[model samples]
Target chain A: MTAALAARDLVVGYRRGRRARTVVLDGVSLTLAPGQFACLIGPNGSGKSTLLRTCSGLQPPLHGELLLAGKDLRRLTRLDVARRVAAVLTDRHDTGRLTGRDLVGLGRYPYTGWFGRLEGDDDRVVAGALEAVAATHLAHRVVAELSDGERQRVMIARALAQQPSLLILDEPAAFLDVTARVELVALLRELTREHGLAVVLATHDLELALRSADTVWVLDAEHRLATGLPEDIAAGGALGRAFPTGSWAFDPVEWRFVFCGTVRGVATVAGDSLHATLARRILEREGFVVNPPDVGPGVQLAIEVLEPPHAAPTVIARHAGGVETHRALQPLADLARRVAADARPGETPR
Target chain B: MLTEERVAAHPEPAPRASVDGQAPARGRAALVFPLLGLLLVVVFVLGIAVGSVPIPVVDVVKVLTGHEPHGVYHAIVFDIRLPRSITGVLVGAALGVAGLQLQTLFRNPLADPFVLGVSAGASLGVALVVLAGASSEATFLAGLGGLGDVGIAGAGTLGAAAVMVAVLFAARRVRSTITILVVGLMVSYLVASLVTVLIASADGPRIQQFLAWEAGSFRAITWSQLHVLVPVLLVGLLAAAAGVKQLNALLLGERYAATMGVDVRRTRFVTIGTAALLAGVATAFCGPIGFLGIAIPHLARAALGSSDHRLLVPASMLLGGTVALAADIIAQLPGADFVLPLNAVTALLGAPIVIWVVLSSRNAGTLGA
Candidate 1:
């Protein structure tokens, strides 16, 4: 099967005035096959949007050949490209009085002749696109009234209404909540499998994008794009270089970046029991660098989880200032919070 | 009802509607057109009947039908009221379509033909003839005949077309719609200041004539002007009607419109040209008619409860024509000797609606503020 979209050493950028060209990305080559979900990840100003725009025919490539469905990109008219590729931009526009159905109906522009009158077939295609995106119920709701998640679903349905072989989106879930983000990614994954669509989405949601993507294209800070399977890319640790460690570190085992808070101070948890283990976990989570019991009371903040005769775990924090008592380990997590806030240096614990 | 299990991929083998199957009369758009058409006729006739002399509706109809020959009523209906009232309809409809196109093209709801400085450009064109040419030497104003209806109207068109070309050039260089709007407004201000300077150059009688023209009136339009007005306005309206697809895609903004195969640049050029032609021609005859171009599209959107241009374009035309005639009657202040300025009536009636739009926005986000 032919690749849905292929770019050979393409250069993407904008032309200033008569001669100056502002190059955003250069020497980029990639091929995306039908039925594959590819996510392009890069930091801001890394040229992800430019690449997506060039691929979807929204912008002319500065150099090199681009082929969409085996046709030279330059050879195709806007309508011809519309018939093959659909794009959803991140820009939020005023929908005003348009119903969800009205918005989705606009997607049939390439096929709808003059006047853009929706025929019966066009209506059904609209309904089917809505159904596929699970937005059938929102068909009559005015787009202005939709929540971000719901509006996004409607927008995706609009693109699907185009019935394109390839779909490109720039930050489609930029404004969605976590649940909505998951649902959107799941929907895109299903679309690739169910419709054989070559889908490419550029996004900041790294974990969500990587979770279900069949292919990953990682662009580093310097505009070097590397493409591979999600597992291979994660294991090879190219993501580390692309998005260098800052306040967060990437966990190789979990294949996701884990956010680390500022360590307030060292805390020694004195117990080998399950309760002690739970206490240590909470301390580390609250930005406490935990020390082993062998490091002893010199650590300044020492927490002991004594096995209680009662059901709850008895916890005690002996600091340089004083000793504090807690009936349970759960609330003991708040001790880290209070100390992190007011206990700068060897201050008294409240 | 074929599922993926039954027919392979869901996108394949869609249940295509047969040729006989067609779109249902969508609820609002269906009712809006004919109802607005009826209202248009009613207001237009009321316009003829409600003027100072108050020819009874029966006589107005009789004169319209040519049942009465060579009477005062005949002269009034055929020569005066008919031209004025029809000019009301023409000016209103032209501004309505032009205004609707501007609002969509800018994505700014407040945008109107005036914002483009088309009217100011026409004012400059008119001032060049009326002010500088009104002197005893006065050769340019009477290049055809003493700044008569045709000469002024022709100058207005020339001026507006010049601004239209300027705006189109500015649009090509500017990428954002917001920037284009600013460019158009600045150009408008620049042209308007030029017109003011010209006003200072003229003497008394010429200044009075220029002031009367600036006041904006439909009554000055004669049947002779209609011959020029109708065809020019028709081309603009036709251009608007043909741009339904382009306008609809444009609602999402230029980038999305481009990806969907709309020639975004061409759409911008055509939209600006059509808008300029409509407002330019109408202003040529009517002399700076205001509010209708901005207000009428909002009225149509409210009436139809839709932003779809097919519905908006026609609804605005009809509603605009009806409202213009109504405003004309009010400006005449039926049964009174003194007439009010058309601009006063249009602004008095339409400004509130714009205020309502501003207050009703849930936040500035919806207005692109």
Candidate 2:
């Protein structure tokens, strides 16, 4: 099947004047197939938004060809592009006294008559779009009265009402809280599968993108676009390098960036997966250099997490001085403090 | 996740309706438009009846329907009051709708043709003609009855269109609404100073005529003048009606409107053009009437509780006509011998309403929202 959207050797930029130009991203190529959920992740000013705008045909590409379902973007009228690709930008418009349904109805602009009168079929489509986003109840409520998350959902419904083949959003989850962000991304993922839409969203949400997206487009500082499966990108270290972790390292296993601190002392953690990872996190936070089980010579300290089914796990810590065991994790903090004191004599452990 | 499944399973109980009962509020809001229409009819008749002559309502109706009432009463009702009242309604409706369009286009609550210097431009055009010895030609044209009104209306329309074009040019350069607003205010001051200079250089009788015109009244619109005013106002209104969808789309901001397939530049041009014509024609006939354009849209929104242009455009027309008639009635003062300046009466009525709307919308925190 042909891709829903394709950019070939695209160079996006703005012309400054008669002769001068500012290039944002150059020599970029990507394709989005139907039913695929792709996320564009990059740091600030890395041209992610510019690329999304270019792909949506909101701005003309300075160089190269953009195709929408194998049709040249340049040949298509704005209405033609609008019919096939819907976009939700980050601009917050104050639609005074407009109901949610009215806003969502605007998505049908290209399909409606000259005066934009909504037929019965158009109303049904708008309702369906609202239903898809679980915002049917908000249909009659004033759009300005809605919360940020609710408004975002309404905007998504508006995009969906267009019934486009591809949907592009720029920082849709920027203003949402953690749970709202997760729910929004999950909702987009579900819509992509159910509606067979090629959904591309530019987001600062790395963790959500890594966890939920089918494919990830990582734009690095050098203007290189790397496309791969989310897991492949994470495993290949492209995602990490694209984001550039300064004080932290991407933990592929945890699917998050973990803080990397200076090594205070060496220790070995031995336990099941859950408890071992938790212990490692706690020790690492305290500046202890934790090693994988049986991987390194951790001469000073050894910690064992004992997990018995249906009971609280017990932590046992061994040091040069003695062995300390506790039923609760709070005791592990105390043990870490003691170890720190022992490691550096006459130094207070805070 | 499970939340999605739960929502799908229990679709009957939509969650938002529980917080706010949307249906009843919407139903109550629906009654406001008809109520405003009824109020307009009452004010329209009152405007025709309660003029300087104090014709009884029955006699006013008789003369309006071509009954041979007393000859003097017939002349007052048919010749004097009817034309003035009609002019009031048309001018009111024109300014009201123009104000609404200006507000939406600029996304500024304080936007209006008068405030944006379009009306001032119209005044400057009339001043140029009346004070610059073109008065003899204008008077000669006035002798030709309706033809004179058309010439003045033409001049006013051209002037207003010129200012609108300048504003549109400035709008392209300035991204901030507040900056554009300040620019419009500067334009108004510039035009006002020029008009002042023209007045200072004019003779006494010309200054008196200009002052009366500046004072603003519907009395100037003779029956013959309506021929020019009505068609111009209607064309402007039709243009505005045709662009209702674009106007509503524009409420979402220009980029989103474009994404919705609206040609932003063309819509802007058409909208500003329509507003200028309406305001300029009204100014030409009524001598730069103020307050109705700025105040009436807010009143309409406050009544209907929606910015949906489909309803707002008509609601504004009715409410604007009503307010203008009411202002004219107060200016005439019916039974009293002395008539207040139409401009002063409108300012008195409009300034309070505008201040009230500003304070209330501000308190409600819906100004920008």
Number of the predicted model whose TM-score against the real structure is largest: 1
Residue-level lDDT of model 2, residues A208-316, one tens digit each, is: 8888888999998877789999889888968766877655788888888775644557778886568767888777776676773444554567889988889888888
Range of the 10 consecutive residues with the lowest summed lDDT in candidate 1 chain A: A341-350
Docking class of 1: acceptable
Tens-place lDDT per residue, model 2, B239-285, is 98888888888887887887777777777767777887788778866
Best by lDDT: 1
Model 2's chain B yields a TM-score of 0.84
Off by over 4 Å in 2: A17-19, A273-276, A292-350, B1-34, B126-158, B171-182, B193-211, B334-336, B362-369
**Candidate 1: pairs in clash:** none
Instruction: Chain A only: list TM-scores of all candidates.
Output: 0.82, 0.89
Q: After superposition, how far is residue B365 of candidate 1 from its true place, in Å?
A: 11
Each candidate structure's TM-score, on Cα atoms with residue i matched to residue i, is 0.89, 0.86
Best candidate, DockQ-wise? Answer: 1
Every model's DockQ: 0.38, 0.26
